[model samples]
Target: FAALARLAAELPPALAVLVGFVDRERRGERTLLFNAVALVRGGVVEQVFHKRLLPTYDVFDEDRYFESGARPLVFDAGGVRFGVTICEDAWNDVDGPLRAHYDVDPVADCVTAGAQVLLNLAASPFTLKKRGLRPAMFAGIARKHARPVVCVNQVGGNDDLIFDGTSAVFGPDGSLWARAPSFQEQVLVVDLAPAQRVAEVPASDEAAALDALVLGTRDYAYKCGFRLAVIGLSGGVDSALVACIAARALGPERVLGVAMPTRYSSEHSRRDAQALAEALGIAYRVIDIDPVFQRHLDALGPSLDALGAPGATDVTWENVQARIRGTTVMAISNRFGHLLLTTGNKSEIAVGYCTLYGDMAGGLAVISDLPKTFVYKVAAEVNRQAGRFLIPENTLTKPPSAELRPNQLDA
Candidate 1:
């Protein structure tokens, strides 16, 4: 309210604000807030709009934090009656992914209330499909209402959620009129009247995928108040790709690549990790974990013998190596305040191929949503785009393995 008061006091007579903010309210026995937007004009608040639809699936838990609003809100802006919809409100369109999730049509209600334009303010997360999904939905809304719809979305990575700005304006005929750049901040000025030119779609699938990861990495580090990053270099496609992304996002000077080798670690694997760091011009450190692993085994052997338990199983020993590496990397991160980037791909993470506290110990998981097969594709794309082997060719070709047991290979 304080922020709104200040803004309203200085609000230009020709302009009005429809912006989102956290709003608090009290029911009979409960006090809760709403993901809300306030309409301000000429030093006064016209209406306080609360978000009606609260998504509670996957990473979204807005239902737990906010109260649902009752109805739609319409306010005048620059002689045009604009309807306001929060992030999920505009997603209630029939053709959208979550159409079944919402029962109310907020946009339709706005149109019934005599709004000339629909303005949706959103902070929606970016999944791979959202690159194409958002524009299609907005265009569909414009065509249905016969009114221009403008969507302004939050950009940059917030933890696991990456918001691709890609803010867009769609004409009543469902033509893309203006589009902001993806994964970055861009100002788009479009005349309220019919657009004279159509907006060009800027990015391809592969390019957008790479940019999304890069922007996510960069924004996650910056927003979390860290400038330096630490990555576990395993000489596999997953870790190699993560290292490349971290170097690109945070710069070589800010990224530190650590290669931890154990008794089972192959010589070529260690060499490949070092080569990657050198090629990327990032600081590199090699830590040998054989001594540490041996000490752990020696210490635990007596306890196991006393318990008369079966000797350490394959999984048990594998976890031991992973945990040791995790511990070492975490210690370095704590000492230097470098945000550790975990390198487990989606395929490994999905089937529990990774150790919980071991390889998964990091401030960020860069490629956890990416499958193992796609990891190679991204690595190849990276090299192809750079016109050289940014990641060593051997790393890309070798069969992936944790190297915790003898003659082990991931096929």
Candidate 2:
């Protein structure tokens, strides 16, 4: 609160601010944290609003750390009365298969309290489906209240969670007044006026998704203090897509593509990887792992025989290749101070098809949320937009494979 007060004191007089933060307060014998928002104007905090609805499901666990607020907070700003609500408060009236857990209607309370406008501050996570549903949810609340609703949402990737900052304003008639771009930061300044009809919002789901992934990748690397990225190019859709994303995020100059091939790796696969690196204009290198793999088998064969496992199973040998590639990439990342990018798609991640210490090793998982089918879709889109095969035609048309064994497909 003191820091926020100091910040507000430094800002220009006409620019009042609503700042969201965690506030600690005494609750009986315990100290509780509240998800709080404070309105600061003229170097003074005029009013404070606490989040009433705490989402406890899935990625959110606010109920464990925060005490729910009891009342709707209304304040006068620029001679207009406005009500403030946190993320889940405005989501109460959303019609969905997901069960509503809260009974209080914060938005309704604000409207009934004579609020002319409503403001919702949110840190909503980005999933493709959840993002698509947001505009309708905000519109519904606006239509119900017969007042303009403005929402400012946080954006960026935090670990596995991605926040697409598609902050927007909606008119009382369920019309969109203004919208900020998704997955990036921007200042949206709109002159307030009476509600009026507007055109339907443009449809760009796939493009928005691509932008989200690109922003998520870039933010994750920057937050972790990485300006350079390293990726193992396997000539598969997952790795191809990951390299493309990393290049887009960090730029071609900052990305390095290393292709590690063992004896089992196909010649065409190597060609595909090299071609992708060339197209992306990223630094490319090939490290042969056959000698290292052969040495491992020779050394471990005796130990396996003594344990009544005379020969390494197919899975074990396959893991050896993966671990070798993983080690190579990690060494490169360490030596060059580059962030390592893992190339596992959502489908493989769901079923644990990837080796934990091997292919799963990376500073970031660039396309881990995209399923296998979606990975291919994105790869094709990349080529289509480029007006040529940026990822190489063979990489797209060839059957998916780990290439750990001869004639082995990714079945």
Candidate 3:
């Protein structure tokens, strides 16, 4: 309580605020309860409101820790009366009579109690399509009540639940005002004017998605205690794109591109790999793997013969080459304590197109989730920013091939 008082005294005033959840039991009772909403000013907490509804079905266990509070919590800050709701409160229609049987009516109780703004604090988990629906739902709520609403979501990966913390605000007219990036923890400040209608603004959805991936990569690498990234430079579009993204996210010097060519590697591929490393300004190393390939073939000669000469085909031969490159990259990673980056794209990862322990070998797969179509787009974007063709134009235009045999393209 003393800490809360001191904090309230030092903090700036806001209309409505939420503190962390409190796990407690009611006085003289053994039942556990989770308190939901709290109003804070400066550093002091003014009031604590327990959640009125709890959900306990697939993936939710809120009822195990919460006793519902029946009434809405209304507080005033910065000349605005705000109504507060915890995660599951607004999710249920029975919490308030006005909200029953309607998507936006429960907020009526807050307005009746003199709340001019609605603030919802949530820790919603991520799904493939849930992100697309959240903004629209909030906008509908705001429009129905003719009041601005602010949503603050918890962010980070907790077990299987990944909170895509893109907190947002909507105007009285149900138009989005500001939105934080997804999958990241961010503090977003929104200026709200009473009865102001939000105007439709152009949004860069692709940019936002790309930024999320970039942030995820950066955080995963840095937070997991990795400073250096190693990429196999095959002079193919996929690897080139991964190299570009890694350089941008973790700085050029932190990224190392290795070009491992064999007897079957095309001259164009070698030249292109060198060009890409120079263009990205990252350190590049050329390690000829012909000797290693020969050693592997000799070691597996008896088995190859037993398997009816499987190594004689172009596909088998290409896979051998890929495994050799994978081995070389892993060796460097082990020696220097760097994170090996796999450059396979989504199109390949799908339908089991990628080799399991070959090109797919890496500590991190940068573009493994990105489709080949998107790979080209992002690579083009990188080049567009560079103001010149840093990735050889031929590399982008050429059909992708494993280059394990003469004149063979990846099917």
Candidate 4:
């Protein structure tokens, strides 16, 4: 508040600033947090708007953490009665996805309170083509209120979350005045007093997903204080795709690929992983796990003999190979202070096809939310967007496998 007050003091009489921040309030021995936006002018905060429509579904938990604001906020600044809203406050479109969630529309409330302009500060997470729908909703709000609507969304990745900054402005006639690009960070200057209007371009589904993953991976690593990443390469599509994302996210020089080959590992798999490493110009290492596998089998052989099992069974040996590989990569990650990236797809995780503390041993699961089918598509997209095979053609075409046992296939 002090910093903003000082900044407001320095601003000219004709200018004002709108900023989003978390507000803390005490209510009868309980501390409450509210997602809020403030309008400032002439060294004083004119009005503060708390978010009303707290979304609680599909990755959102606002209702659990925040106290909803009781009323809308409208304040006079620079000859305009600007209305301030924080995120979900302006998302109550009649035909929108969250329309049924709330009865009162914040946009309508602002206009009813005599607001000339509408402003929404948001941190909306990216999902498929979710970016395309927001502008349409804002346009509707602008048309209904007869007020120019401006939306500023957050950009970059936090943990596994991706916020696409497609900030935009619309005229009272429901026409787009200006827009910032999706999945990128840039300062957008909007002139709502525009002469010409442009239509909103629909974002491509595959392209947007690729960009979101890359941004999420980059921001997640940087925020966690990791400049380097390591991935256990199986030369399958899943690992190959993750390597591509890591290389792009942290630069090829910061990514390391380790291939742990065992007795059941295929020769083509080794070559394909190496090919990808060379193509991306990342550090690569090959470790033979057969000797280690032999040691484990020897140590467990006597214990298994008591269980009436002669040799390694489906319940044990295949997992032994997986655990060996996981340990190898984890050691590399820990030794070099690298973030270990797991390559298991959502389908495997959903059905518990993943090994505990084995293939699942990593600092982050890069593709745990990606399905096996979508894995192939996004991997191909990595190559397609590059206009060349950064990931080898054979890697995408080959049958998916963990190579933990002979004649095994993930299909």
Candidate 5:
């Protein structure tokens, strides 16, 4: 109560503020209900709107801790009347009474009371395609009431339930005016020019997708307490792009690039990798893994030859090289206490193209969700933003290869 009073005091005068809160009280009943509604302005809260519907099925336990309130909350804000509802309010036809049942329809009451806009605040959890339903619901509400509607959602991964906070707004004509990015915290500011009715081209969906991935990477790394990220630079596009993202998110100094060359690694690849590292201004190391590979092959030569598998076979030799490189990188990661970043893209992961426990060995997969095509797109955007080509042009143009075995292309 004191905190609310202090916040209200600091807020601008005459501007209406609606706060949603859950009320808990021990009545004669043994069961509890989760209640939510608007805290009206002018120091008086008239209507008590409650969440009549509660999900008890999967990954939810709302019915265990709340007593549902029994009315629709309609309030005045900035000379335009508005209706505020909680998360489950939109799903129910009527808010029910008693410990478990209350009868009130906030949406109907808002329309009856001439609400110009309807606003809903929610902490809805994410399920596969659950977000797709929000657009239709908001659009239907706007078109039905002949008023604009705004939905604000809380976003973040909360335990087993991830709240994808893609808040959306619709005009009176049921057209989407604005939408926030998913799976992240963002404050979306939209200018409500009701008089102009000018329809601008919708923003690029690709930009939003990329931004989400970036945010996901940043948050996962930082929240997981990884201060330094190390990548195995093969002079290929995947590793280069991952290094770029890590540098951008955690600063260049925090990202370390290790160019582990072998007999198959070309001189051009090494030069390009070095150029990229210099351009990004990150710590770089050239660890030759040829000695390590040869030692392993020599040690396993008797067993490999006795098993009727030739050492020169492409598959056997390539896999041995990849495993050796993986082992070397893991050893470096353990010694230096740096987070090893795996450089496999979605295209590789989807088709099982990546060497298991080899290139896929990392604390977190940065580009696991991005396809090979999108990886290049993001790299291009990064270079475009840098003005000059910070990422080496040769790195981007050259065909990607693991360079694991001698004379072995990534076929």
Candidate 6:
């Protein structure tokens, strides 16, 4: 807090900075830590307030860190009593899913303490449903309390969690004053006048999803020190979607598409992979696994003598082909120092339809969270967003297949 106060002292006198950080205070004889937001002005820290509510669900484990504050923080600022809350403080409502867990509604408590406006500093991560749901939730809170609400949410990706920074302002009558863009950073300055409402057009679900994926991929690679990406192009929707995301995330020049074709590989699949790579203007290469695959068969033939080593007809041989393709991609990843992207979808992974070390081998599973059905939807959105057939039409219309065996289909 002192360091932040010192930094705040350097700012212009007209501007006040609200900074969130860990604060240490003396309680009795023991020093305790708190998750606090400090209001700084006049070359010093004017006031500081702790986060009252701490969530301990999903990726959050606030209880394991600093202690929760005992009371709400309501202070006078610019002739208005501004009520302050942290991320989890505003999450608990009488009508919410966590109604039974807590005995407090921070927003209501703030209003009870004579607050005219509410400000929530949040770091909420992005999800498919939550993107649209947050505004409605905040608007409801504002209407219920009859106070204008401002929520400034963090934006950017940190590992697997992606924060879509859609900071917004809602009037006391539940009118939207302003809304920042998703997955991007912008300084939003909205006048408190009730007459100046910006008519914001919400992004479609597919459009929001595409932005999320692109931001996630870009942040994950850049944060992990990866400048290039590589993908195993199976000529299927899942791999195609991943490839398109990679192209957009880390420019087409930084992406490599590899197709490891074997005897069971279809001609159309090879063509589709090449065409998709070409359409994206990414690097394309084809590797035939016949030599290494046949050597593996020859070396393991004696061990499988009792288990019927009937050439490539055995069920276990299917896994071998997938593993060879996996190895082919990983080898390229190692040689080029690229981030390898896996192409398995949620449905296939849930039912254990994919091989263990085969299709699952990669630094990142780009489309693993998307189900087979949703994968197709996003793939279409990719083309629609481009206003052209970036992914070939046949790839979308054709039946899904792994092509690990001759005349094979995922069905």
The Cα error of candidate 6 at residue 137, in Å, is 0.9
| lDDT by residue for model 1 (1-411), tens | 888888888888556777678998877898889899988877787789998888888788998888899987888766778888998899887476756457898889999999999999999888767777778889899999999999999988887788888888889998877777778887677786565444444446666677789999998899899899998898888899999999989999999999888888899999899999999999999989889999989998788668876654437778989999999999999999999999999999898888989999998999898888888888888898889999999998888888888888976
Candidate 4: clashing residue pairs, number: 0
Model 3, runs deviating above 4 Å? 1-17, 20-38, 42-74, 85-114, 122-133, 153-166, 176-189, 194-206, 307-317
Q: What is candidate 5's lDDT per residue for 147-235, written digit by digit as tens?
A: 88888887764323446677878888888878776766666667654432222311343344444455556666767777888988888
Report the lDDT tens digits of candidate 3 across residue range 8-67.
Answer: 677776434567557455576575666665567655677877666566765888667667
Q: Which stretches of candidate 1 lie over 4 Å from their true place?
A: 26-32, 96-98, 193-204, 302-313
* TM-score, structure 4 vs. true: 0.93
Q: lDDT for model 5, on a 0 to 1 scale?
A: 0.71
**Tens-digit lDDT track for model 4 on 223-332?**
98999999988888889999999999899999999999988989999999999999999999999999999999899978987888554445588888889888998898
Best by lDDT: 1
Better candidate by lDDT, 2 or 3: 2
Alpha-carbon deviation at 276 in model 2, angstroms: 0.5
Per-candidate TM-scores read 0.92, 0.94, 0.76, 0.93, 0.71, 0.93
Superposed model 5: Cα runs more than 4 Å off: 1-81, 85-115, 122-141, 153-169, 174-206, 310-316
Clashing pairs in 4: none
* Residue range 90-190, candidate 6, lDDT tens digits: 87753654342577778788888998989999999988878657888888888888889999999887887889988889998888888777788888778
Candidate 1 is scored at a TM of 0.92
Q: What is the C-alpha lDDT of each candidate?
A: 0.86, 0.85, 0.74, 0.84, 0.71, 0.85
RMSD of each: 2.4, 2.2, 5.3, 2.4, 6.6, 2.4
- For every model shown, the clashing-pair count is 0, 0, 11, 0, 12, 0
Superposed Cα deviation of residue 135, candidate 3 (Å): 3.2
- lDDT for 305 in candidate 2 is 66
